[model samples]
Target chain A: MAKGRELKGRIKSVENTRKITRTMEMVAASKMKRATDRVAAARPYALALGDVLARLVRPDIAERFPLLRQPATTTRVALVLLTANRGLCGAFNTNLIREARARIAELEAKGATVELHVVGKKGIGFFKYLGRNLASERIDITDRPSAADAASLIDGLTDRFAKGDLDAVYVTYAKFKSALSTPPSTEQVVPVVPPATQGTPRDFLLSPNADVIVEALLPAYVRNMVYRALVETVAGEQSARRTAMKNATDNASDMLTLLKRTYNSARQAQITQEIAEIVGGASALQG
Target chain B: MAGALQVSVISPEQVLYEGTATSVTAPAFDGELGILPLHAPLMTLLGTGTLRVESSEGLKRFHVAGGFLQVVDDTVRVVTEEASLVG
Candidate 1:
């Protein structure tokens, strides 16, 4: 009986863990739903803004814009990598880092230098191990990031681009596809390039003037791009946590099932042995 | 400045304020600048401070931080750094 005590204790511990993992799974599920909705709600506006901005750049103003100008060298690129502030979800940060490293290598293959702008703490700590200096980053921008915060960061990126300190700006994050799937993505942030097949801009009124309107829309465009990525990253994080918890729950349940089987077999074997001993003793007494 | 000018304050997150107002006053880096209806088309970089838009009822104040201001045609668009309306 005491020999099986260790197994019993192990089972108890596992059950406790299963309870916690189950709770975590539910919590992650709720968060995943909220984050998914947030990303979806924000998309139409961002896409509309992007499309509007694509057309707003008049040919003349485009000539003077530094962001539009091509750089002499492609040696150095600035990567703005976004990851969750804390670690728990499996492979979330790892996959992002893997993509970022590949992107860096690709840029380097083009003879460009690479700089990191780590958004979350995990990225900062990871890149620091390789002796990289982050151009600029914001931490603790989880839950819902304020539009202003996104704008402020874009302002910094704009400065770097204007100064020609960076050849191009890139952002890497996990794009939320669904509750079960999110893929890591690297996107170009600046030079305001619209897809070739973009639709025409609507003829909205020029409130103050056309130039002012364009100017207003440009920064908004930048903010939209970054905020969308951030929101998507959060959603991806939640989904990853949910998936990890689900696996843990399933594994625990399997372990408990196996233990129950072993426990029954062991109990039956002990009962049979006891009966045999009692019968043998009675026969020996009668003899 | 015959009538109220249509002004919209937009951020990346959402459209903060969009309506018609008699005048718009903002805190610029050097000083405060006011925009009126049919104001000359121009653009200026905004600094940190509160922005005010006036109407017949009263003046509404919005807190804003670093961004730019632009006026084109007759519309005044303030793309603020950080914007919050007075409660």
Candidate 2:
């Protein structure tokens, strides 16, 4: 049985914890809203670029551009991994690392060489422990990153591809599914996938011939794809944090409730014991 | 036919501009390069400077630094290192 003083002290401690969790929850919610908006705003560029890319990848342009050509061998691949700069959210980094491990194992089983361009401290830590060879690395890109950053990485990747250093390039990150669920997703960001051509791509008249247009469009395709992925990654981070903070707040509340019950029962038991002692003394005096 | 090219100026945060332009001028690595409708299929490294595009309204200028320009058919995709508009 806890004394009133002890119960009050315990409640105060729980209250302090609750306040901290509540504050975190609010911060996470604000970040989630901003991240979601950024992701949505970036989508048009991604889709429009894809449309232009689809038009560029005609049978004719495929003949001219090495990037457009389908590879005869699936021997080696490079993955640029983006993850959280920090780790407070639940299972966000875990899911991505798990996905990457499985992917690397699969590639190894197929006798395909796998290289990595690790972005964020999470990826750096994960691969460093595994002693994996990294193609390139950048850490701590959690906040908003400009298109210029994307270009620097893109230049590195494209140069390697141009020199035939890597056969394919992929980007791995957590895709923002919703507030409660962010799924780890991997997409090919390099050797840009030509958009699917269903409509009559030839219907639109080109200022230049289609060949020139195709030539001009490939890099734009890459930038948009990378930018979209980053936006989704940021959104996913916010969602994960919001979800984690909410759970924390809920857990703290439950703990407070349980503590309160224990405290009250303890309080009642002491009162009853004290009353019994006093009444028993009165009865004894009368006897 | 030659004057119209699909030029999209985009930033990571938003699609800054997307429309039909009669002519487009970009900051190419070597110098400023202009594209008319029937310009050659070209892949050029971008430089920091003014990105000029002609539309129905008049000439639109974007202050840009570094990127790449890819021209295919009627589409000109300007991937700028950094871009801001000039009034």
Candidate 3:
């Protein structure tokens, strides 16, 4: 009887845990949908920006823009590492940190001085524990990132790059390929790589000139790139979290089932013992 | 549709407007520039001011800041950093 009672307690606790995991799974699923929608909504602006850039980035025209000027040699580089502030998202932060560390090592191997700018609480904590120097640490910008947020981050980086203080700027984050896949990747943000000309260039009347327009456009372009990275990283975080929560919920369900089976068997054993005791008493009384 | 130009106003967050407009007046870096149908292909830096789009329905104005305006093939695309409807 005691064993049956203990089994019932175990089952009840497992059922309570299952309820919590189920709720978490639902919450993550909803958040993932919203994040994915944000990613989709931001696509047209990026494409439009790309279209404008493609038309303006001829070799001769690009030479006039300081943002397009490649450094003579890469001496110093900045790596902006993006991770999540919260960490229930299984291996998401871990994979990103590992990838960032590898990139830093590679950059160091090439003799470039790397300035680490971390953008999440988890990344900051890990690096701090490792006693690594951080150029800047930010944990404020949450899931919903605005254009101003991107502009703020780009302002300092672009100023330094324009002033020749930094040779190159690279951003590392998880690129949202799909809901199921997010791969850690890095892209160079400075010395803007002009996309190849697609078709015949149209003769557009430049207001001031291509050079002046490009001068204004490059900064905006850099900000947009940073914004894209931030949004994609958020989407990836949600996706990772949804997957983790789903697995957790599933595990909880399995545990509950196993516990229920064990409880039933314990109850059956208790009942059998009770019946056996009653039968022995009857036989002894008859004797 | 022949007289109207297809206009898309897009920001980093959302597509504020996408439709046909008979005319568009945007704030260029220097001053306000008005674009009508069959205008030449043009590219100009945008400034912070109201972007007015007039169609058969009515005139819609958006407070736009810091981006670019591109006109090609009777299609005008205004890509701004931020755009919101003026109250």
Candidate 4:
């Protein structure tokens, strides 16, 4: 009886866990759809921007643009580590943190002072635990990151880079390739690197001339890069959460099945033992 | 269709319009610029104002701010980060 009762309690607990996981999986699935749509929706702008840049920027034209000027020697750098605030999502946060740590290590080894600017509470907590110095910590941006949110995150940093206070800035995030694969990658955001001019350049009537336009466009370009990274990181987070919840639900179901089988056998054995005791007592009374 | 230009109004969040337009009037940084078919390759920074596109369906207007416009051959692209449809 004791064994049977204990098994029943175990089964009930597993059932509750299964319910929670199932709900989480469904929630994550819906969120993933929206996040992926954002990814697609943002593509046209990126393409059009790239189209304009490729046609507009050249080595000679970019030479005068401060943002496009690559630092001769990278001495001071800033790294923005993006992680999800909550932790239910598998290794999503872990992978990003690991990647950021390695990047900081690599930069420091090269005699560059790495300034750690972290977003999301999970990353902040991890760094705080290690007593690492953080230039800034922000937990305001959620899974749905807006352009304004991105601007707030990168504006000050870019201004510093332009003024030569910082040599370079890099962002570390999970690159969403697909639902099945999201690898943590680091991308340089400052000292804006223009894509190599492709094909033959077209000569167009420049509106405010090339110099001013390129200067303004480079900052926008940097903001776009940061925005894109945020969007992709969000998508990857949701996908990872869904997969993790799905696995959890499956495991819970399996555990419940095993517990039920053991409970049934324990109940049957107790019934047989009681019957045997009754028969023995009756035989002794008759003798 | 001979004189129609292929036009696309693109914003960061979504594509506002994509069709053939007879004419397009964009608010360039300095002033308003109009385009017809076979316009020479041109690029300009956009200011905050109305963007009017006239097509077979009728005229489509958008309020766009702080972006750029490009025209090459018969293709025109109006890309703005902040844009919304207007009556």
Candidate 5:
């Protein structure tokens, strides 16, 4: 009876856990859909921007823009680390932090002073535990990153780089490849590189001329890149949470099955022992 | 068909319009820019204002803010930070 009671308690607890995980899985799935759609929505703009940038970055035009100028010496750099605000999403944050640490090490090894700008609570906590100094900490933008959020996030970094205070600017984030795969990636976002174009150059009616437009476009381009990263990171986090919750739910189901079998056998054994005791008493009384 | 340009007005969130238009006018950073069919290749920064597309179906307008406009080979591409149709 005691054994049966203990098993019952365990089964109840496991059942409760199963319910919680199942609900979390559903929530994550819905969030994943929204995040994925956001990423998809931003793609057209990114592609169009890329097309325009390819044409705008002529050699002469490229030379005039400050963003297009590569520093003579890469002495100072900034790393914008994007991670999840909350935990329970498998290795999503861990991988990003690891990637960031490695990048910092690499940059430091090359004699460049690396400034750490961390986004998300998990990254902030991890770095704090490690006693690492953070240039800035942002904890609010992980759940719903708007265009304004992206613009403000990179505004300071862009300004510093333009003023030659920071030589290079890099963003480390999890790039959403698919539902099952997201790899942490580091990209140099500043010193705007002219993406290669395939066709011959065509003359354009210069409205305020190409040089002026290029200068304005460069900042917008940086803002868009940051926005893309934020969107991708959000999508990746949702997918990771969905997968993690799904695994947890499946494991809970398996545990429930094993517990049910144990409970049934324990009850059966107790009943059989009670029957044997009753028979033994009757037989002794008759003798 | 003779005086129409392929116009695509794109925002970060979605593509507002993608079709043929007789003329397209957008708010450039410096001022307003007007485009017609066979317009030479042009690239300019956009400002916060109204974007009017003169299509055969009638006139459609959108409030656009902060982006760039590119015209290449009779195709006009308007990429903006934000865009919404004007009621």
Candidate 6:
């Protein structure tokens, strides 16, 4: 009876755990849908911006724009690590942290001073535990990221790059390829790599002139890039969470089935033992 | 059909409009620039102002902040970050 009761308790707890995980899985799935939609919606603007920039930006003009200026030597660099605020997602935060660590190591190996900027609570906690210094840490950003959020995040870095204060800037995040695949990756946002000019150049009318327009356009392009990374990371996080929760729920169900069967068998064994004891007492008294 | 221009107004968040329009007036950096059908290819930075899109149905207006406008082969693409419908 004691064994049966214990198994019953375990079964109840596992059922509760399964319920929670099931709820989480559904929530994550819905959020993933919306996040993926956002990633798709943001694409047209990026493509059109790239198209215009490709036509306007050339080798000579690129030299004039400070944001597009390539530093002759690698000395100082900024690594912006993007992670999720919460840690329920499996390996999402861990992968990003690992990628960032590797990136920092690579930069340090090249004799560059890396100024680490981390976003999300998970990343901040991990770096703090490691006793590493963070140039900046922000917990305000959430799954619902906006263009203003992106601008606020990257504008200062872009300004420093333009001022020649920083040699280069890199952002590490999970790139959402599909619901099944989101790989951790790093991209250099500074020294804007101009997209290869498509087709032949056309003599297009430029308002005021090319220099003024390019100056204004380059920062917008950078902002778009940051926004894209933010949205993609959110999508990846939700997808990872959904998969993790699904697996957890499945495991809980299997455990519950096994525990229930054990509990039933234990209860039946106790009943048989009681019947046998009563029958033996009657037979002994009769004899 | 020959006179109408294929227009796409895209923001960072979503595509606000994608259809044929008679003309598009965007807030260029220096000043307001208007695009009619068959306008020469042009690229210009946008300023914060009202963007007007005239079509057969009516005139659609948007409050656009920073971005650019591109015109090529009768396709007017208005790409801006801060854009919302204006009443």
Q: What DockQ, on C-alphas, does every prediction get?
A: 0.13, 0.23, 0.89, 0.75, 0.74, 0.84
What is the CA-based DockQ of model 5? 0.74
lDDT, candidate 2, B36-57, per-residue tens: 8987666556678899999987
Q: On a 0 to 100 scale, what is the lDDT of residue B6 in model 2?
A: 85
Give per-residue CA lDDT, model 3, range A10-89, as digits (tens): 87887888788778778878888988888898999988887888988888876677789899999899999999999889
* Weakest ten-residue segment in model 6 chain A by summed lDDT: A199-208
Q: Candidate 3: which pairs clash?
A: none
After the best TM-score superposition of candidate 5, give how far the Cα of residue A83 lies from its true spot, in angstroms.
Answer: 0.8
lDDT of 5 at A250: 98
Q: What docking grade does candidate 6 earn?
A: high
* Ranked candidates (DockQ, high to low): 3, 6, 4, 5, 2, 1
Estimate the lDDT of model 4: 0.90
How closely does chain A match the true chain A in each prediction, as TM-score? 0.91, 0.92, 0.96, 0.95, 0.97, 0.96
| lDDT over C-alpha atoms for residue A2 of model 3 | 82
**RMSD (Å) of each candidate, 1 decimal:** 5.5, 4.9, 1.4, 1.6, 1.7, 1.4
The CA lDDT of each predicted structure is 0.76, 0.76, 0.90, 0.90, 0.89, 0.92
Judge candidate 3 at residue A21 and give its lDDT.
70
The best-first sequence of candidates by TM-score reads 3, 6, 4, 5, 2, 1
Q: Quote the positional error of residue B24 for candidate 6 in Å.
A: 1.2
lDDT of 2 at A165: 75
Q: Which stretches of candidate 5 lie over 4 Å from their true place?
A: B1-4
> Could you tell me how far off, in angstroms, the CA of residue A102 lies in candidate 2 after the best superposition?
1.1
- In terms of lDDT, which candidate is stronger, 1 or 6? 6
Q: Which parts of model 4 have CA positions greater than 4 angstroms off? A: A278-287, B1-3
lDDT per residue (tens digit) for residues A1-287 in model 6: 77887888899899999999999999999999999999999999999989888988889877888999999997999999999999889999999999999999999999999999999999999999999999999999988889999999999999999999999999999999999899999999998998888877788888778888788889999999999999999999999999999999999999988898888888889999999999999999999
- B14-84, model 1: which lDDT tens digit per residue? 55777888999988756798888887765666678889988676788888876666666667777654577
Q: iRMS for model 6? A: 0.9
